[model samples]
Target: MALFHVRMDVHIPHDLDPEVRAQTVAREKAYSQELQRSGKWRELWRIVGQYSNISIFDVESADELHEILQGLPLFPYMDMQVMALTRHPSRID
Candidate 1:
């Protein structure tokens, strides 16, 4: 498995319908939880004072991560930054 760090910032248009926003957000939550339960999504943290989150994912490949991100309900409204992670030699666990 490969590890990745992903930062996602969400931007929902002010003109979007409230009902649609609600449903999309709900779906995004459920999907995120599902991924967590499956162990693909390893960690999640919210950015203070922002509609953004930083998460870690363990997946088969970058393509798999790409597919997973694209499957998010709010994909179109998100700006994401992703980086691959590797253990530091000096770190002891």
Candidate 2:
């Protein structure tokens, strides 16, 4: 398996009329575990934001990353920008 950095910019409903956010959060957490069990998830994080959240993660590949990013249970409620990534060099040991 190879290592790949995955970054996504995700947008969701802000009003929270019916808690689309809550449901999605639950599903996403479950999905994160699923990916981990599948030996595909390396790391993941969500950044705080006003209307949109940016996420960063490392996975096995672009294809695997895409399938995982689909966010199965809540895919319809949001939009995202996914991209493969590279890490910069470290300053020192």
Candidate 3:
């Protein structure tokens, strides 16, 4: 499996309808949970004072990671960066 570091910043428009925002958040959370259960999403850390997050993912390939990310409910409103990871030569895993 390959490891990836993904950083995401949410950019939902301020004038968006409240009901739609609520539904979007709900779906996003549910989808995130689904990824967690599937073992593809490994860890998530919320950035303080911002609508952003840093996540670690374990997947087979970059294509699979892209597929999983595009499946997110908030993909349209998110600015994301994905970096492929490699084990450090000095580290044991």
TM-score of each: 0.98, 0.55, 0.96
Q: Which pairs clash inside model 3?
A: none
Worst 10-residue lDDT window for candidate 3 reads: 84-93
Q: What lDDT tens digits, residue by residue, belong to model 1 across residues 1-93?
A: 999999999999999999999999999999999999999999999999999999999999999999999999999999999999999999989
- The model with the greater lDDT, 1 or 2, is 1
What's the best-to-worst order under TM-score?
Answer: 1, 3, 2
Give the worst 10-residue stretch by lDDT in candidate 1.
Answer: 84-93
Candidate 2 residue pairs in clash (backbone atoms < 3 Å): none
- Deviation in angstroms for 70 in model 2? 1.8
lDDT of each: 0.99, 0.62, 0.96
Instruction: Please give, for residues 1-93, the per-residue lDDT of candidate 3 as tens digits.
Output: 999999999999999999999999999999999999999999999999999999999999999999999999899999999999998999966
Candidate of highest lDDT = 1
* Overall local distance difference test of candidate 3: 0.96
Off by over 4 Å in 3: none
* Candidate maximizing TM-score: 1
Candidate 1 stretches with Cα past 4 Å from truth are none
> Which is the winner by lDDT between candidate 2 and candidate 3?
3
For every candidate, C-alpha RMSD to the true structure in Å: 0.6, 3.9, 0.8
Candidate 2 residues 1-93, lDDT tens each?
446554444455677656767877787779878777766775656666544444545566677666766755656665666656654597464
